[model samples]
Target: MGPDGVDKKILLNAFNMNSVGHICHGLWTHPRDQSADYARLDYWVKLAQTLERGKFDGLFLADVIGANDVYGASPDAALLQSVQVPINDPIVLISAMAYATRHLGFGVTANLTYERPYLLARRFSTLDHLTGGRIGWNIVTGYLDSAARAMGLTEQIRHDDRYDMADDYLDLVYKLWEGSWEDDAVVRDARNGRFTDPAKVHRIRHDGPFYQLDAIHLCEPSPQRTPVLYQAGGSPRGRAFAARHAECVFTNSLTVDLTRSIVADLRRRAVANGRAAEDIKIFSGVIVIVDRTEKAAQEKLREYQRYASPAAGLTHFCASIGVDLSRYGPDEPIEMEGTQAMVAALESITRYNPGRPWTVRRLLELMKLGARNTPIVGSPSQVADQLTAFVRETDVDGFNLMRAVTPESYEDFVDLVVPELQQRGAYKEDYAEGTLRDRLFAGRGGQLPSRHYGRRFRYGAGEWADEAVSRQAGRRGT
Candidate 1:
C-alpha cells in the first residue's frame, strides 16, 4: 500500500533489450528462461499480449549497434557473454508486436549519434502510421567509444558536444514533422479528384552546422506527427538535453532521495525551458522477484545469482563509463577520468556507502540484481508495498521494470505482483484511449500540446507567420 490514501495512477513499462542477455547478463543460461527466443517473432508477440493483459503502459526496448570491448582492452569477454553485441534491430520487431496488441505502446531506443535525422524521422512516422500511433522514440546519444569507431569515427565526441549535435538534429526533425504539412492537407476528395492541396504542403529549409535539408517532408502527418520522445541519459549534459526534449525520462538510482532530487532538477530545468513540469514523465529502473513466501523469494534470488555473469556486467560498465575495469585488481578502486558518466557512476556508489570505497568486486556484486537499481525480493503483497512506498517517497511517474530472468521473471510479475498492485489500486485496471503519447499524457490528446517546443512548427490554416507577414506587406502597397 502507498500511504493512508493515495489515488494517483502509476505507469508501468516492461524494460527489455533486443538481445539474449540484457540487464541480467547471463540469465539466458537459466533453464526456464526463453531469452534465446528473442530472434523469433512469436516471442515478442506473446510478450506484447501478456503485457496488454496486465494493463502495462508500454514495452521499452533498448538497442545497441556496436560491441562492448572496453573491458580487458579486448572484445573476447563481451563476445563470450553475448553482452549486447549480436543484437537485432529493435524497430523491425515493433510492427509484429503492434499487430498482436492494440493498446500497448512501444518505446524503441535509437542512438542519434550515428543516424541521420531526416531518415530517422521518416522511419518513425511510417511506424506511427502502421501501429496507428502507438509508437515512441527513446533518444540516446550513445556512450560507447566502440560505437564511434564502428561508425567510422576516430573516437566518441565530447559529452556536451553530442548534446549540441542532438539539439540541431531535433530542430530539423521538428520542422519536418510539425511545419512541413498543414492539418487539412490530406483532403482525399474523390468527387473533386484532389488527393491533397499542393498549396498547403510547404517545403522546409534547414541549413544548420550539423545537418542541411531543403525539401518537403516525405511522409504526411500521422496521428501523432512526432512520436512521444523518451530519453535515458542521466549525466549532467544528458539531463540538460532531456530537459529540453524528453517527454519521458528514464533513470536508475539506488535511493529515493537521490531519485527525487534528480527528478526535481529535471522538472525545474523543463520549467526554465518554458515547458510544464508535469509534461515530462520520470521512470526509474526496478527489478522484482516475488513468490508465495519471503523464503521462496529469497530462494529464487539465490537461484538467479547462480546465473549472473560478472564478465558481462564488467563489459557493460566499461563501455558505458569509458573505463577499462580489467586493469585493476578485484579489490582495487577504479580511478577513471575524461567522462561524466564515470564520475556519476562513481558518485552514486560512494553516496550509497560513504565509508567503504567502491572497487571492481563491489560493483560486480551490486550488478547481480540488474545494475544499480534497487531489487525487491518478497511475496507479491510485500513487493507491491515496497513499490508503492518507493513511488510515494520519490514522486516518480512510473517504473521501467527489469527482469532477473527471461519470460519467467516477467511471468511471475504479471501473475503475482500485478494482481497485488491492482488490489491496492496502485496499478492501472485498464488502458485509456489513443496513441502512446495519448496514453502517456492521457487527459491530453495524441498531439503535443502548445506548451511543448515542438508545437512551434505546426502549420495553422496555411497562413503561418511568414505568409501572414507577406500578405500584410502586399496590403500595405509597398
Candidate 2:
C-alpha cells in the first residue's frame, strides 16, 4: 500500500519468449520444465490459462530474428544453450492462446526493420480483430548483427538511425490503420446487398523514403485500429521515440532512483511531443521469487541459481547491448566508446551509483538475478511491500515479471504474491472492460485519449476532407 493509505494497483505482464530457454538459460533442462514443449499448441494454451487464472494484464512475448552469436564471436555457445534462437514466430501463437481466454491480452514483439509497414498494419489489424482488441505490438528495430545479416544486410544500422527509420515506419502504419477508412466505412446492409461503402474507404498514397503504399488498408478498423503500442527501448534516442509513439514503455533499472529518472525523462519528452505526461505508461522488468516464508523463498532462489548460466546471461547481454564482454578484464571498467547499447547501459549504472566504479566482474555478479533489473525474493507480503515501495519510489506504472523457470516461477507468483497483492488491494482481482488499451487505461475509454498524438489521426466522417483536397491540389500543382 502507498503512504497515502490508498492501494496502488500495478499492471502485471508475464514476460516470456518462444524459444526453449529464454533468460533463465539452462532451466529448460529442469525436470518439471515444459518450455521444451513450446512447439506444441497445448503448451501455450496452458500457459495462457494460467496467466488468466492469475488475472494478469497481458502475456508479453519476446522474439528474436537471430541467434545470440555475439558472446564468443560465434553461435556455438548460444546454440549449445538455446539462448533465444530456434524461436518460432510469436504471432502464430497469439490466436491459439486468445482462443483459450477471454480477458488476457497478448503483447507480441515484432521487429519493424525487415517488415513493410503496409503488411504489418494489416497483420496487427487482423490480430486486434481476432483477439477482440487484446493485442499489443512491442515495436523493436533489429539489434543483433546476426539479424541484420540474416536480412541480407552486412550489419545493423546505427542505434539512433534505427529509431529514425521507425519514425517513418510509424507514420506509414498510422496512415493505414487510422486514416485509411472512415468510422462508418463498413455497413452490412442486406436489403440493398451493400457491404463496405467504397467512397468511405480512402486509399493511402504514401511516398516515404522507406515504404510506399498506394492502396486502402485490407482490414477494416479494428476495435483498436492501432494495437496498444508497447516499446522497450532503453537508449536516449529510444526513450525519445517511445515518448512520441508508445502507449506503454518497458525498461530495466537496478535502482529505484534510476527508474525514477528514466520515467521522469520519458514523461518530459512526451510532454514536449504534444502528449500529456500521464498518457504514457512505464513498466520495468522485475523478477519475484516469493513463498510462504522468506526462508523458503531464499531456498528457492538458491536452487534456481544453481541452474543459472552465467555464459548464457553474458550471451543475452552481448546481443542486446551490442557488446562483447568477453574482451574485457574482470576487474577492468567497461569501456563504452563504440556501441550505443554499451554506453546507454554504462551511463545508467554510473548514474545509479555515482560513488562506485562498475567493472566487468561487478556487472557479471549483477546479471545473476536475470538481467540488471531489481529482483525481489521473500515472502508474499514482504515481496508485495517491496513492490509497492518500488512503485511509489520509482513512479513506474507496473512491472514485466521475468520467469526464472518455465511455469514454476510464474506459478509461484500467481499462487503466493498475487494473492497478497490482491488482499492489500495493490493488484486487480479482475480484468477491466474493453480492449487492452481500455483495460490499461480503465475508466479512460476504449480509444487512445485525446492527449495521445495517435488520436489526431483517428478518422471521423469527412474528417480529412480539407487535407485530401489540399493534397489533390498540390498534386495538380495548383
The lDDT leader among the candidates is 1
Runs with alpha carbons beyond 4 Å of true place in candidate 2: 1-7, 340-343, 349-353, 460-466, 469-478
Q: What pairs collide in candidate 1?
A: none
> What TM-score, over all chains together, does every model reach?
0.95, 0.95
Q: Candidate 1 at 45: error in angstroms? A: 0.7
> What is each predicted model's overall lDDT from 0 to 1?
0.84, 0.83
- Cα lDDT of candidate 2 equals 0.83
Q: Model 2 clash pairs?
A: none
lDDT tens digits by residue: candidate 1, 127-178: 9999999999999888777788899998888778888999889988988898
